[model samples]
Target: MNVIIWNCRGASKPSFKKRVRELVQNHNPAILVVMETRVGGDRAREITNLLPFDEAIHTDATSYAGGLWVLWNADRVDITLLSSTEHEIHAKVKVRFTNVSWLLSAVYASPRNAERQILWKNLMNVAELHNLPWVIAGDFNEPLLSEDKFGGRSVSVNRSLLFKECLDKCKMLDFGFAGPRFTWTNRREVQALI
Candidate 1:
């Protein structure tokens, strides 16, 4: 099934809403996974209503960072919110078209290497327990390889290795980076600084 994952930075911009609409019309994904939504409860509800999706789940906005939301086209998918933590959300659902069951986890990793390692470990544990076809998608905040970056920066050998190991151990594929080579930019307008 088609799925879209984006870290919108925040949902405050009119551009963000316009882009979401465009994505829905153009991609028509069964599921839309959004990160850094920067909205909670009422605002989240308002935003979800504007989208074509029938249901949405988001964490408490009071949390340190704005939370995640999974918007699903109810006609094409049956979504059961399995669990949610401060940094991730887990769901168990079947893709309507293929009838493929998936243990889907959408995550936004901490920028710090140490915290990310811990998060990855925890995520891997959950995946191992389920033993179902799984997809983990979000702003990992760490490039998998030197090639993933625009210019040569010292790729964190240990962190990169751990990320790869976690995915391999969990049997989840990276799916290859799509759209822009870099998903984030700095205020300076310098490209590929992430």
Candidate 2:
């Protein structure tokens, strides 16, 4: 079973539904985690209903920023909500017709260093609560290494240090990426990856 996690920036855009539909059609993921929705309330509900997923849970956007939506196909997988904060959604997923069961934490970490520290701590608490095989994925908003970033101020070892410590304590390792060394860029003349 495949899970697709996307930081879509904003879900209120005119093409949001079309883009999501295409992703669903192309990838056919059992679960789709959307971060940074920047929308909530009635509008969020409307959008979720339009999507192809059979079930969904949304962490509403605060003001104009930060929202997370976890959608899944009920026929393909059964998902049980574990807990959630503005920064993450923790759940247990069981694939249909199988004995497989695991924890999935979809994160949308804050850009602020302090807030992200809280996220790390919360994740550690969650880890201690369950021994099931776990998959944690999303936009951490903090690069874990100097090499994970390019073009801009040098990475702050202090921040990366905390992140690394959290990973070590949680016994989690970066899955890394293919295709591009950097998944994000500033898009200006002075481009940086994170």
Candidate 3:
């Protein structure tokens, strides 16, 4: 079953709901994750209700910066929450189409370097608990290689190595992507794929 995840930037904006509705109509994902919501409290709940899913889990915004919402169509997917924090939502989801069960971690790693390692630790904890194949997806805020970045202070070798180590320790591998090589851009249009 298809799952759509978006770093929508902010769900509080005027047109966010309409765009999400359109996306839900077009992709029809069994599970939907919206990150960097930039809103919390009852507003986050309102946005979740507006989406086309019967069930949702919300991680409130932290200091008005990062927020996460996980929504799923009850008929297409059954999910059990394993663990969660502001940085990630970890779950075991059973897809009806494939009749398979596995772990899903919807992560929004902190932009702050100091907080990134905590997320890595969280994944290691997840690995310790479940042996199922995993699918971790999000704007991790760190890239795996020098080639994954562009127009930045040369990418951090230390950060990249730490990311690699985390992946190795967790026995996880990149699923790779089919889109433009540069998936993100700066004010100058200099790009990076993370």
Candidate 4:
């Protein structure tokens, strides 16, 4: 099944609606996870309702900082929310016409080390909650290796170490990505990837 994870940055942008429609047409994903929506409450609800999804769940942003939405086409898969926090949303997804079921965690990790510690702990806890196949996806907000950064301060070994430990503890593997080596940039010389 196809799943699309996008850090749309802000759902309130003028082009947001058009961008989402394009993604839907191109990918035809069964599940779509949007991060850093930068909108919350009734505004978040209103915007999400306009998206072309059969169902959705969201965690509101804190005054335009961080927000998350998980949208899906019910005909493709049945999704049940297991739990949610500002940093992450855990759900049980069952594919139609198949016996396959899996746990999906969509994360919008904090840049702050302290807050990220909470995210790591929470992820570990979620890993222990079920034995089903699990997939975690999102903008982690921190690089895990030296190669993950460019045109900036060297990557912090301490930060990468903590993240590495967490992944090892959770028995999770990084599937990496395809296409460009850098997925992000400051547009002013600094380029980074994760």
Candidate 5:
């Protein structure tokens, strides 16, 4: 089943909602993970209205810093919310047609480099604890290679290596991506950003 994981940055913007709707229409994902929402309360409800998912679980923002929304098509998949935190949402998803279950971890990794290592350690612990077939995805904030960076400054090799080591230690494979080479584009013409 197709699952779409996105770090939306914020959902309050009309443009973001429109883009999300387009993505939903295009991909028709069985499960959807939206991270860094930066909005809550009525705006969250408004964001949900624009999507096709029947059921949703939300983690509210902490002072405009982070938020999470996990949406799933109830008719297609049965989802059990196992656990959640400011950085991750763990769930067990069973596809009704296949009668198969797997663990899904939706992560919004801390942008802070130091904190990211801790996040990786926690995720590794989860991996060790749960032997279930797992598919973990989100905006990890660390690119694995030079090619992974589209237009940004040279990525930190140490950060990339740490991420790679964690994945290797956990025996997880990169599912890779399709469509856009860069998930983000800095169109603002900012010098330091690029």
Candidate 6:
């Protein structure tokens, strides 16, 4: 099944919506996982209607920036919101094509190492309980390898190590960081020859 995960930063912008629409038209993934929606209340509903998918699970409550949202083609998949935490969201569903159960998690890890460790532990517990083939995707905010970053130290080596440990514990595989190598860019131009 085709799945698209993006950190839209926020879907409130006109340009962002237009770009997302373009992506939908081109990719038409069976499931769409978005992070940092930065949307709330009626605005979230407005954004959901634009997509082909009829069902969505958005952040019920949050303590930080943009919450998570998962939209899927209702007819093709059955989704149930298992649970959600302050920093992570979890959903359990069965993909019709494979007749296999899967769990999809959208996570926005805290930048702080201590908080991130806690998040990692919580995720492991969730994964263990579900006991299904799963895919967790979002702005993990940490890259496993040095290749994931451009220049300078990537920061959070210990945190990145923890992320890797969680993935390994859950027996999950990285989808190979498809699309753009760098999802964010600074306004100031700094040329680097790699």
Alpha carbon lDDT of each predicted model: 0.79, 0.89, 0.86, 0.89, 0.83, 0.76
* lDDT computed for candidate 4: 0.89
Clashing pairs in 3: none
Candidate 1: tens digits of C-alpha lDDT, residues 32-76: 999887777788888888878888878654454657888898888
9 Cα displacement, candidate 3 (Å): 0.9
Write down the worst ten-residue block by lDDT for model 6. Answer: 185-194
- How far in Å is the alpha carbon of 21 misplaced in model 1? 1.5
Q: Candidate 2, TM-score vs. the true structure?
A: 0.93
Cα shift from native, residue 31, model 2 (Å): 0.2
Point out where model 1 deviates above 4 Å: 61-66, 151-153, 189-194
RMSD of each: 2.6, 1.7, 2.5, 2.1, 2.5, 2.8
TM-score ranking, high to low: 4, 2, 3, 1, 5, 6
Q: Worst ten-residue run, lDDT, model 2?
A: 185-194
Model 6 alpha-carbon drift over 4 Å, by segment = 60-64, 152-154, 191-194
Candidate order (lDDT): 4, 2, 3, 5, 1, 6
For candidate 1, give the lDDT.
0.79
Candidate 4 residue pairs that clash = none
Total clashing pairs in model 6: 0
* Candidates 2 and 6 compared by lDDT, better number: 2
Say which prediction, candidate 1 or candidate 3, comes out ahead on TM-score. 3
Q: What is the lDDT of residue 189 in candidate 1?
A: 48
Instruction: Report the lDDT tens digits of candidate 4 across residue range 1-194.
Output: 78999998899999999999999999999999999999888898898889999899899887788899999999999999999999899999999999999999999998788999999999888877789999999988778988787667889999889888889888989898888877666667323422
Please say which candidate is ahead in TM-score: 2 or 5. Answer: 2
Task: Please give the lDDT score at residue 11 for candidate 6.
Answer: 73
Q: What is the lDDT of residue 123 in candidate 5?
A: 85
